[model samples]
Target: MLDQLRQIADGLGQTLAPFCEVVVHDLLEPDQAILAIHNSLSGRQVGDPATELGMARIADPDFTQVLANYANQFADGRQAKSTSIGIKDASGRYIAALCLNLDLTLFRGLQSAMNQFMRMDTEGPRESLDPAGGADAIRARIDAFAGRHATTPRALRTDERRALLSELRAAGLLDVRRAMETIAAHLGVSRASVYSYAR
Candidate 1:
């Protein structure tokens, strides 16, 4: 059954070739698990030792299958995205492992180009002090404060509300008379309740 699976592994390697390196490991022989390999991106040979994933399967019967993508670097320092899967026998024992390592250098270069192409000017506009916009700014600040405390603005405790008001006052947001009204409306509290928080 394991030998039959080797052809599938080889086919996968060829299909994903150039970028992908695929290897088959025989778990019974930890010292030389590499039974077959394709693409050979890692430069590992048929007689190479089992990887950490194979060793884990050997140590733990429950490690039947492991499919994870992780960062890996080749001996030549080239970065790769690797996925390893452990195959098991009928009795729940891991018998073989298959691994696919994908070179990420080309994708990373494309990502850099995409970022440059999609770049935008972040300093396009400055904020305005219009009453409606000011109210939005005040609500945004309160929401940010609530987020820091892991709660919603309406769910803030009295002490938390007091601290939030203190921060707002220190930021000069409460200097405008309508700012308190805006905060009170946003918090579902009365203007007097908002004022008490300032103390």
Candidate 2:
């Protein structure tokens, strides 16, 4: 049974390799309970004494059979997430245990980087990505419309230009001063073409 447990531990360790350590403890041998250790993240050897939790399982059969995602750390103080499962014999005597400890440093680092990359600037660029109705807003809306088609404003087809102008006219964006020139310049068209499309 202990050998079978060791094989299972080795399989689990390989499956979660580089970041996780899988340890099997022979609860009956508290003095040297570690029957197998794989992935070796915790720097523990096979002959090491059982942990306090293992001792608890030995001292009390009623101890929790499974403790999952509990906070833990390595001797080097790196953070870890752990899950422990206790096995019992036919007579309900606690016999062995399997524990997996996953290092969280890499995950935490990735989380930190994502947070940094996604963080918006609170101190620079006085402009807003979503401004209220104005020339800036009109420009932002037009740019977005073009972006939806995976193209730039200046590259929109004549029919697309007419549709965009129609929308701007309905939205009263055309009422702004120099709106026609603005649209013409932004769309890389002549002012006469803007007037023609606005119809």
Highest TM-score model number: 2
Q: Pairs clashing in candidate 2?
A: none
TM-score for each predicted model, relative to the true structure: 0.58, 0.61
lDDT of 2 by residue, 105-136 (tens): 99999999999999987898776443233667
Model 2 weakest lDDT span, ten residues long: 128-137
| Candidate 1 lDDT, 1-199, residue by residue in tens | 7787799888998899888999899999999999999999888999899988789989998764767788889989999988888887888888888889999988899999999999977889865666555777788999999999999999999999999999998988997659989999889999999989997
Least accurate 10 contiguous residues by lDDT in model 1: 126-135
**Pairs clashing within candidate 1:** none
lDDT of each: 0.88, 0.90
lDDT of 2: 0.90
Distance from true location, Cα of 171 in model 1, Å: 39
